[model samples]
Target: MSHDAAMSVQHPQDIDQGHVVARYVSNERRYLKLLGGGFLRLGEAERAAFIAALRADALQVSPEEIGALLGYEWRSRLTAAWLVGVARRIEWRERVGELLLASELTYAGQGYCFALAQFGGKNDAEILVSYLDRYLPHLECRYDQGLALGALLRLDSRLGTSHAERFAVRDGLWERWVDALPHTRGTADAWADASRSRIDAWCNLWDA
Candidate 1:
Protein backbone atom coordinates (compact mmCIF):
# COMPACT_ATOMS: atom_id res chain seq x y z
CA MET A 1 0.00 0.00 0.00
CA SER A 2 1.03 3.55 -0.60
CA HIS A 3 2.22 5.42 2.49
CA ASP A 4 -0.78 7.72 2.43
CA ALA A 5 -3.08 4.74 1.95
CA ALA A 6 -1.61 2.99 4.97
CA MET A 7 -2.15 6.10 7.01
CA SER A 8 -5.73 6.32 5.79
CA VAL A 9 -6.37 2.75 6.90
CA GLN A 10 -5.79 3.63 10.54
CA HIS A 11 -9.11 3.93 12.33
CA PRO A 12 -9.90 7.38 13.64
CA GLN A 13 -10.38 5.95 17.11
CA ASP A 14 -7.12 4.05 16.74
CA ILE A 15 -5.41 7.21 15.68
CA ASP A 16 -6.57 8.94 18.84
CA GLN A 17 -5.55 5.98 20.90
CA GLY A 18 -2.27 5.92 19.04
CA HIS A 19 -1.69 9.44 20.23
CA VAL A 20 -2.00 8.24 23.78
CA VAL A 21 0.24 5.30 23.00
CA ALA A 22 2.76 7.45 21.18
CA ARG A 23 3.08 9.55 24.25
CA TYR A 24 4.38 6.47 26.03
CA VAL A 25 5.77 4.21 23.27
CA SER A 26 9.26 5.68 22.94
CA ASN A 27 9.16 5.11 19.17
CA GLU A 28 10.23 7.86 16.82
CA ARG A 29 7.80 7.18 13.96
CA ARG A 30 4.91 6.80 16.34
CA TYR A 31 5.92 10.02 18.05
CA LEU A 32 6.26 11.71 14.69
CA LYS A 33 2.76 10.65 13.67
CA LEU A 34 1.20 11.65 16.97
CA LEU A 35 3.07 14.93 17.34
CA GLY A 36 2.57 15.88 13.71
CA GLY A 37 -1.13 15.16 13.94
CA GLY A 38 -1.69 16.68 17.33
CA PHE A 39 0.82 19.47 17.83
CA LEU A 40 -1.19 22.18 16.16
CA ARG A 41 -4.51 20.87 17.36
CA LEU A 42 -3.46 20.47 21.00
CA GLY A 43 -5.35 22.57 23.50
CA GLU A 44 -4.04 23.35 26.98
CA ALA A 45 -5.78 20.25 28.29
CA GLU A 46 -4.22 17.98 25.69
CA ARG A 47 -0.84 19.49 26.35
CA ALA A 48 -1.33 18.89 30.04
CA ALA A 49 -2.35 15.33 29.34
CA PHE A 50 0.71 14.76 27.19
CA ILE A 51 2.93 16.17 29.92
CA ALA A 52 1.30 14.01 32.53
CA ALA A 53 1.78 10.94 30.40
CA LEU A 54 5.41 11.83 29.84
CA ARG A 55 5.94 12.18 33.57
CA ALA A 56 4.29 8.88 34.44
CA ASP A 57 6.69 6.23 35.75
CA ALA A 58 5.13 3.60 33.50
CA LEU A 59 5.75 5.77 30.46
CA GLN A 60 9.33 6.70 31.21
CA VAL A 61 10.83 6.84 27.72
CA SER A 62 14.44 5.92 27.24
CA PRO A 63 17.18 8.32 26.32
CA GLU A 64 17.58 6.28 23.16
CA GLU A 65 14.09 7.27 22.12
CA ILE A 66 14.96 10.90 22.50
CA GLY A 67 18.24 10.32 20.69
CA ALA A 68 16.44 8.61 17.82
CA LEU A 69 13.98 11.44 17.47
CA LEU A 70 16.82 13.89 17.54
CA GLY A 71 18.63 11.97 14.82
CA TYR A 72 15.72 10.91 12.63
CA GLU A 73 16.37 12.05 9.07
CA TRP A 74 12.77 12.23 7.83
CA ARG A 75 11.33 13.82 10.93
CA SER A 76 10.77 17.51 11.48
CA ARG A 77 13.71 18.89 13.48
CA LEU A 78 11.52 21.64 14.84
CA THR A 79 8.94 19.18 16.03
CA ALA A 80 11.62 17.14 17.71
CA ALA A 81 12.91 20.29 19.31
CA TRP A 82 9.43 21.07 20.58
CA LEU A 83 9.31 17.61 22.09
CA VAL A 84 12.43 18.45 24.02
CA GLY A 85 10.66 21.55 25.23
CA VAL A 86 7.82 19.34 26.40
CA ALA A 87 10.29 17.01 28.09
CA ARG A 88 11.67 19.91 30.02
CA ARG A 89 8.19 20.86 31.16
CA ILE A 90 7.61 17.27 32.24
CA GLU A 91 10.57 17.64 34.63
CA TRP A 92 12.95 15.30 32.86
CA ARG A 93 15.99 17.18 34.03
CA GLU A 94 18.37 14.26 33.79
CA ARG A 95 17.41 13.61 30.18
CA VAL A 96 19.15 16.79 29.19
CA GLY A 97 22.35 15.05 30.18
CA GLU A 98 21.52 12.29 27.75
CA LEU A 99 20.93 14.85 25.02
CA LEU A 100 24.31 16.37 25.74
CA LEU A 101 25.89 12.97 25.39
CA ALA A 102 24.16 12.07 22.12
CA SER A 103 26.61 11.71 19.25
CA GLU A 104 24.92 13.91 16.67
CA LEU A 105 24.27 17.63 16.79
CA THR A 106 20.60 17.92 16.06
CA TYR A 107 18.40 20.99 16.15
CA ALA A 108 16.43 19.09 18.75
CA GLY A 109 19.60 18.76 20.82
CA GLN A 110 20.22 22.44 20.36
CA GLY A 111 16.73 23.28 21.59
CA TYR A 112 17.03 20.88 24.51
CA CYS A 113 20.39 22.28 25.45
CA PHE A 114 18.84 25.71 25.55
CA ALA A 115 15.99 24.42 27.67
CA LEU A 116 18.43 22.74 30.01
CA ALA A 117 20.24 25.94 30.59
CA GLN A 118 17.02 27.86 30.98
CA PHE A 119 15.05 25.62 33.32
CA GLY A 120 17.91 23.63 34.73
CA GLY A 121 19.10 24.00 38.28
CA LYS A 122 22.66 24.75 39.40
CA ASN A 123 24.02 21.37 38.37
CA ASP A 124 22.38 21.65 34.98
CA ALA A 125 23.92 25.07 34.53
CA GLU A 126 27.34 23.68 35.31
CA ILE A 127 26.86 20.85 32.87
CA LEU A 128 25.70 23.23 30.13
CA VAL A 129 28.66 25.54 30.72
CA SER A 130 31.02 22.62 30.53
CA TYR A 131 29.35 21.36 27.34
CA LEU A 132 29.53 24.78 25.73
CA ASP A 133 33.14 25.26 26.67
CA ARG A 134 33.97 21.84 25.27
CA TYR A 135 31.77 21.76 22.15
CA LEU A 136 31.27 25.33 21.03
CA PRO A 137 34.38 25.30 18.88
CA HIS A 138 33.19 22.30 16.87
CA LEU A 139 29.46 23.08 16.54
CA GLU A 140 28.23 24.40 13.21
CA CYS A 141 25.13 25.84 14.82
CA ARG A 142 26.79 28.68 16.65
CA TYR A 143 23.36 30.23 16.98
CA ASP A 144 22.59 27.45 19.44
CA GLN A 145 25.59 28.53 21.43
CA GLY A 146 24.18 32.00 21.50
CA LEU A 147 20.89 30.63 22.75
CA ALA A 148 22.80 28.73 25.40
CA LEU A 149 24.51 31.93 26.38
CA GLY A 150 21.16 33.62 26.71
CA ALA A 151 19.92 30.77 28.87
CA LEU A 152 22.99 30.93 31.09
CA LEU A 153 22.46 34.62 31.55
CA ARG A 154 18.98 33.94 32.74
CA LEU A 155 20.08 31.09 34.95
CA ASP A 156 22.30 33.28 37.05
CA SER A 157 22.70 37.00 36.68
CA ARG A 158 25.47 36.91 39.28
CA LEU A 159 27.61 34.41 37.43
CA GLY A 160 29.30 37.39 35.96
CA THR A 161 30.69 40.22 38.12
CA SER A 162 27.73 42.49 37.47
CA HIS A 163 24.65 42.60 35.29
CA ALA A 164 26.36 45.07 32.95
CA GLU A 165 29.26 42.75 32.36
CA ARG A 166 26.83 39.93 31.84
CA PHE A 167 24.83 41.89 29.29
CA ALA A 168 27.95 43.03 27.51
CA VAL A 169 29.21 39.51 27.23
CA ARG A 170 25.77 38.17 26.35
CA ASP A 171 25.32 40.87 23.68
CA GLY A 172 28.60 39.97 22.11
CA LEU A 173 27.88 36.26 22.44
CA TRP A 174 24.48 36.65 20.77
CA GLU A 175 25.83 38.26 17.62
CA ARG A 176 25.93 34.88 15.96
CA TRP A 177 22.36 34.27 17.11
CA VAL A 178 21.25 37.61 15.62
CA ASP A 179 22.91 36.81 12.32
CA ALA A 180 21.37 33.36 12.16
CA LEU A 181 17.86 34.49 13.13
CA PRO A 182 16.75 35.12 9.56
CA HIS A 183 17.52 31.57 8.50
CA THR A 184 15.96 29.65 11.40
CA ARG A 185 12.70 27.74 10.91
CA GLY A 186 9.60 29.69 11.87
CA THR A 187 8.62 27.04 14.40
CA ALA A 188 11.84 27.75 16.29
CA ASP A 189 10.94 31.39 16.70
CA ALA A 190 9.01 30.85 19.90
CA TRP A 191 11.98 29.30 21.65
CA ALA A 192 14.30 31.88 20.22
CA ASP A 193 12.00 34.71 21.18
CA ALA A 194 11.56 33.41 24.69
CA SER A 195 15.31 33.10 25.08
CA ARG A 196 15.78 36.64 23.81
CA SER A 197 13.09 38.07 26.05
CA ARG A 198 14.57 36.42 29.12
CA ILE A 199 18.01 37.76 28.31
CA ASP A 200 16.54 41.18 27.61
CA ALA A 201 14.71 41.20 30.91
CA TRP A 202 17.89 40.34 32.75
CA CYS A 203 19.65 43.21 31.03
CA ASN A 204 16.80 45.57 31.78
CA LEU A 205 16.63 44.55 35.42
CA TRP A 206 20.23 45.47 35.98
CA ASP A 207 19.94 48.65 33.95
CA ALA A 208 17.00 49.82 36.04
Candidate 2:
Protein backbone atom coordinates (compact mmCIF):
# COMPACT_ATOMS: atom_id res chain seq x y z
CA MET A 1 0.00 0.00 0.00
CA SER A 2 1.02 3.58 -0.57
CA HIS A 3 2.19 5.44 2.49
CA ASP A 4 -0.93 7.57 2.56
CA ALA A 5 -3.13 4.53 2.12
CA ALA A 6 -1.31 2.71 4.87
CA MET A 7 -1.73 5.70 7.18
CA SER A 8 -5.45 5.62 6.56
CA VAL A 9 -6.04 1.92 7.11
CA GLN A 10 -9.57 0.88 8.07
CA HIS A 11 -9.75 0.08 11.78
CA PRO A 12 -12.21 -2.78 11.96
CA GLN A 13 -15.25 -2.57 14.25
CA ASP A 14 -14.01 -5.76 15.84
CA ILE A 15 -11.29 -3.66 17.42
CA ASP A 16 -13.74 -1.30 19.13
CA GLN A 17 -16.94 -2.86 20.37
CA GLY A 18 -19.84 -0.63 21.62
CA HIS A 19 -18.78 2.11 19.23
CA VAL A 20 -20.81 2.20 16.03
CA VAL A 21 -19.16 0.84 12.92
CA ALA A 22 -17.77 3.55 10.66
CA ARG A 23 -14.67 4.66 8.85
CA TYR A 24 -11.95 5.13 11.48
CA VAL A 25 -10.06 7.42 9.14
CA SER A 26 -12.89 9.93 9.41
CA ASN A 27 -13.34 9.68 13.17
CA GLU A 28 -11.34 10.44 16.34
CA ARG A 29 -8.91 7.70 15.37
CA ARG A 30 -7.74 10.16 12.77
CA TYR A 31 -6.29 12.19 15.63
CA LEU A 32 -4.66 9.00 16.86
CA LYS A 33 -3.47 8.33 13.32
CA LEU A 34 -2.14 11.88 13.00
CA LEU A 35 0.07 11.26 16.02
CA GLY A 36 2.39 9.68 13.45
CA GLY A 37 2.83 12.77 11.26
CA GLY A 38 0.24 15.27 10.14
CA PHE A 39 -0.23 16.59 13.69
CA LEU A 40 3.28 18.06 13.67
CA ARG A 41 2.84 19.93 10.40
CA LEU A 42 0.11 22.27 11.59
CA GLY A 43 0.48 25.97 12.38
CA GLU A 44 0.67 26.92 16.07
CA ALA A 45 -3.07 27.58 16.47
CA GLU A 46 -3.99 24.47 14.54
CA ARG A 47 -1.46 22.45 16.48
CA ALA A 48 -2.99 23.61 19.75
CA ALA A 49 -6.44 22.65 18.53
CA PHE A 50 -5.14 19.32 17.31
CA ILE A 51 -3.48 18.59 20.63
CA ALA A 52 -6.69 19.49 22.49
CA ALA A 53 -8.72 17.21 20.28
CA LEU A 54 -6.24 14.37 20.73
CA ARG A 55 -6.45 14.64 24.51
CA ALA A 56 -10.24 14.79 24.36
CA ASP A 57 -10.36 11.80 22.07
CA ALA A 58 -8.03 9.86 24.31
CA LEU A 59 -10.49 10.11 27.18
CA GLN A 60 -13.18 8.51 25.01
CA VAL A 61 -11.12 5.49 23.89
CA SER A 62 -12.04 2.25 25.57
CA PRO A 63 -9.49 -0.12 27.08
CA GLU A 64 -10.34 -2.60 24.33
CA GLU A 65 -9.55 -0.01 21.68
CA ILE A 66 -6.25 0.83 23.35
CA GLY A 67 -5.31 -2.86 23.45
CA ALA A 68 -6.15 -3.21 19.78
CA LEU A 69 -4.12 -0.13 18.89
CA LEU A 70 -1.12 -1.41 20.76
CA GLY A 71 -1.40 -4.71 18.89
CA TYR A 72 -1.46 -3.09 15.48
CA GLU A 73 1.44 -1.86 13.33
CA TRP A 74 3.92 0.81 14.42
CA ARG A 75 1.84 3.86 13.61
CA SER A 76 -1.14 2.70 15.62
CA ARG A 77 1.11 1.60 18.42
CA LEU A 78 2.71 5.02 18.46
CA THR A 79 -0.72 6.60 18.54
CA ALA A 80 -1.82 4.36 21.38
CA ALA A 81 1.23 5.23 23.41
CA TRP A 82 0.72 8.93 22.83
CA LEU A 83 -2.93 8.67 23.77
CA VAL A 84 -2.07 6.74 26.90
CA GLY A 85 0.49 9.35 27.90
CA VAL A 86 -1.70 12.36 27.20
CA ALA A 87 -4.57 10.86 29.11
CA ARG A 88 -2.31 9.83 32.00
CA ARG A 89 -3.71 6.31 31.83
CA ILE A 90 -1.70 4.95 34.70
CA GLU A 91 -3.25 1.50 34.44
CA TRP A 92 -1.39 0.87 31.22
CA ARG A 93 1.98 1.98 32.60
CA GLU A 94 3.46 -1.48 32.94
CA ARG A 95 2.25 -2.52 29.53
CA VAL A 96 3.97 0.52 28.01
CA GLY A 97 7.11 -0.33 29.96
CA GLU A 98 7.07 -3.87 28.58
CA LEU A 99 6.79 -2.57 25.03
CA LEU A 100 9.67 -0.15 25.68
CA LEU A 101 11.94 -2.96 26.82
CA ALA A 102 10.86 -5.17 23.93
CA SER A 103 11.66 -2.43 21.42
CA GLU A 104 9.49 -4.33 18.98
CA LEU A 105 9.02 -1.56 16.45
CA THR A 106 10.91 1.47 15.12
CA TYR A 107 9.18 4.73 16.05
CA ALA A 108 6.93 3.34 18.76
CA GLY A 109 9.71 3.48 21.34
CA GLN A 110 9.59 7.25 21.13
CA GLY A 111 5.94 7.10 22.15
CA TYR A 112 6.69 4.60 24.89
CA CYS A 113 9.35 6.89 26.28
CA PHE A 114 6.93 9.79 26.21
CA ALA A 115 4.29 7.77 28.04
CA LEU A 116 6.74 6.59 30.68
CA ALA A 117 8.03 10.10 31.21
CA GLN A 118 4.50 11.36 31.56
CA PHE A 119 3.87 8.70 34.18
CA GLY A 120 6.82 10.27 36.04
CA GLY A 121 7.19 7.57 38.66
CA LYS A 122 9.88 5.31 40.09
CA ASN A 123 8.53 2.35 38.13
CA ASP A 124 8.92 4.32 34.92
CA ALA A 125 12.48 5.22 35.87
CA GLU A 126 13.24 1.59 36.66
CA ILE A 127 11.95 0.50 33.29
CA LEU A 128 14.16 3.03 31.50
CA VAL A 129 17.16 1.98 33.59
CA SER A 130 16.48 -1.62 32.62
CA TYR A 131 16.27 -0.67 28.97
CA LEU A 132 19.56 1.15 29.19
CA ASP A 133 21.09 -1.84 30.94
CA ARG A 134 19.97 -4.14 28.12
CA TYR A 135 20.81 -1.94 25.12
CA LEU A 136 23.64 0.43 26.15
CA PRO A 137 26.05 -2.51 26.27
CA HIS A 138 25.19 -3.26 22.66
CA LEU A 139 26.37 0.01 21.09
CA GLU A 140 25.67 -1.13 17.55
CA CYS A 141 21.95 -1.60 18.30
CA ARG A 142 21.62 2.24 18.40
CA TYR A 143 17.94 2.38 19.26
CA ASP A 144 16.03 4.66 21.65
CA GLN A 145 18.87 4.96 24.16
CA GLY A 146 19.00 8.74 24.02
CA LEU A 147 15.28 9.27 24.48
CA ALA A 148 15.12 6.62 27.16
CA LEU A 149 18.00 8.19 29.06
CA GLY A 150 16.53 11.64 28.77
CA ALA A 151 13.18 10.41 29.99
CA LEU A 152 14.91 8.68 32.89
CA LEU A 153 16.63 11.91 33.85
CA ARG A 154 13.36 13.79 33.60
CA LEU A 155 11.78 11.26 35.91
CA ASP A 156 14.79 11.38 38.19
CA SER A 157 14.39 15.12 38.65
CA ARG A 158 10.69 14.77 39.30
CA LEU A 159 10.99 11.74 41.62
CA GLY A 160 14.33 12.58 43.31
CA THR A 161 16.49 9.84 41.80
CA SER A 162 19.84 9.71 40.04
CA HIS A 163 19.39 6.84 37.62
CA ALA A 164 21.06 8.67 34.74
CA GLU A 165 24.32 9.69 36.43
CA ARG A 166 26.08 6.33 36.08
CA PHE A 167 25.30 6.24 32.38
CA ALA A 168 26.69 9.76 31.75
CA VAL A 169 30.02 9.15 33.41
CA ARG A 170 33.10 9.27 31.16
CA ASP A 171 33.42 6.35 28.70
CA GLY A 172 30.11 5.05 30.02
CA LEU A 173 26.83 4.21 28.29
CA TRP A 174 26.22 7.81 27.28
CA GLU A 175 29.60 7.97 25.63
CA ARG A 176 28.89 4.66 23.94
CA TRP A 177 25.68 6.17 22.53
CA VAL A 178 27.55 9.25 21.33
CA ASP A 179 30.18 7.07 19.67
CA ALA A 180 27.44 5.35 17.70
CA LEU A 181 26.30 8.64 16.24
CA PRO A 182 27.35 9.76 12.76
CA HIS A 183 30.99 10.78 12.32
CA THR A 184 30.12 14.46 11.95
CA ARG A 185 28.67 14.60 15.49
CA GLY A 186 31.38 13.41 17.86
CA THR A 187 31.18 15.66 20.90
CA ALA A 188 31.07 13.66 24.13
CA ASP A 189 27.93 15.39 25.44
CA ALA A 190 26.18 15.92 22.09
CA TRP A 191 23.88 12.96 22.47
CA ALA A 192 22.99 13.78 26.05
CA ASP A 193 22.21 17.39 25.18
CA ALA A 194 20.06 16.42 22.23
CA SER A 195 18.24 13.86 24.34
CA ARG A 196 17.07 16.50 26.83
CA SER A 197 15.62 18.60 24.03
CA ARG A 198 13.76 15.63 22.57
CA ILE A 199 12.25 14.60 25.89
CA ASP A 200 11.45 18.18 26.77
CA ALA A 201 9.53 18.60 23.55
CA TRP A 202 7.42 15.56 24.31
CA CYS A 203 6.81 16.57 27.92
CA ASN A 204 6.01 20.17 27.08
CA LEU A 205 3.37 19.31 24.50
CA TRP A 206 0.59 19.92 27.02
CA ASP A 207 2.26 22.56 29.09
CA ALA A 208 0.89 26.08 29.32
Best of the candidates, lDDT: 2
lDDT of 2 by residue, 90-192 (tens): 8999888877787877777888998899888898999999999988888667678888988988888888889999999988877866777588246757767
CA-only RMSD, every prediction: 10.9, 5.5
lDDT of 1 at 180: 45
Give the alpha carbon lDDT tens digit for every residue of 40-71 in model 1.
25687765565455335223444444444443
Which numbered prediction scores highest in TM-score against the true structure?
Answer: 2
User: Which 10-residue window in model 1 sums to the lowest lDDT?
Assistant: 1-10
Estimate the lDDT of model 2: 0.74
RMSD of 2: 5.5
- Clash list (residue pairs), candidate 2: none
Model 2 bad stretches (over 4 Å) = 1-41, 181-185
